[model samples]
Target: MMPAEDLDAEYPEDDWLSLSGIQHFSFCKRQWALIHVEQLWDENYLTAAGHIEHQRVDDYSESELRGDVLSIRGMRVFSRHLGITGICDVVEFHRSSRGISIQGREGLWEVFPIEYKHGTAKTIDADRLQLCAEAMCLEEMMVCSIPEAALFYHKTRRREVVELDDSLRDTVRADFQQMHQLLSRGSTPSAKPSKACDACSLRNLCLPELMNKKSVSNYIEMRLHEFVTDD
Candidate 1:
């Protein structure tokens, strides 16, 4: 068995990373560095709407029991190994024999974490990655394995089940390690604009226009080469 200390990956409380930042990190490292590293922000309608949605879901004191399942809203969680802390939008505890016992609760209960999002399901794994990170936090705090979690999209009004596969878990771990290194160095990476930049809330503040601009000399040289080749 691994030593408890090594298993936990514990860090000083002050050094804990924000679990929500995982989504932004996965989407774009430069964007993550800008926000989390440099403390910069430029929110548009999309971000503001998402923020409102999150605020609505964050009823931390609320928990509902129905049948054999208990659902908790805005449950705070943390992981010692990942050195991250976050809140799950909703975590359902289902009664089961192969689960852990909860304080003041009867019988064993399995955990199911759910993350709420503003838009429809994304083609990228940004949201899924964040959900996986949240599961890691819950697993560490509860001392159990959360084999699966879910993403609930407000726009679609549907739930997408996510398997906590080895690949995703590994990525989550690796991403956090990279994030820590970047943060420790106080380095924000240079921007590389892409199609995703179209939807990024930080597009204006990130100055992708300047970064993407081609030099006049280079443009003229290329045009001359094209003209000569044609002749």
Candidate 2:
């Protein structure tokens, strides 16, 4: 059997990384490493709104719901031992009735983690990966088996359930490794311009304009050469 330490090693944290790194890793590895590892940050209206939303989620105290379910809001959880840490928006515990039997064995309650987002559903799987990272943190901290989690989008006004399968686990592990590798190497990824770049709060600092200008200039130079050669 693989040692638990090996599993825990996959999640490593230093002053260079944050609980937010999980979200960053999902959005863009280069962007992720830049802000967290390189300390480059620029805030815009959208990011400001997201910051407020996270603050609201992380400010509440622990509580229970419906008497039978225990709920923890804005729970600050981190396992340095596991090398991962993040604030969970809400963790709902569903307690099975005492003496309840399943398959001739006593059954216990389960944990279901729900993360709230201020945006609509994204085309990328970053949101799902973020939720999965939270579940991994929960499993490590609480020593419980959390097979799945859910993402609640304010724009969609709905919840999307995500399974914590091997694929996601592998993604989380690989991302953590890649982030650490970039930080240790002190390397930042090159800018990748996309329509999504327009929406990023760091667009200005990231210099999408400069990059686009360079791209256009290069294209013009190439076209001029081609036209002159055709004469």
Q: Over 4 Å off in model 2, which ranges?
A: 1-16, 80-82, 97-108, 212-231
Best by lDDT: 1
Per-residue CA lDDT of candidate 1, range 1-231, in tens?
333455546777788899999999999999999999999999988999999998888886667899999999999899878889988999999999998999999999999999999989999899999999999888888889999999999999999999999889888888888898899999998888888899999998897777768879989999999999999
- Deviation in Å, model 1, residue 149 alpha carbon: 0.6
Model 1: colliding residue pairs: 8-81
Candidate 1 runs further than 4 Å off: 1-8, 214-231
Please, what are the lDDT tens digits per residue for candidate 2 over residues 4-96? 566645443443345668787788676786697678898888888888887766656645566556677887677553366777888877767
- Model 2 global lDDT (CA atoms, 0 to 1): 0.73
Best candidate, TM-score: 1
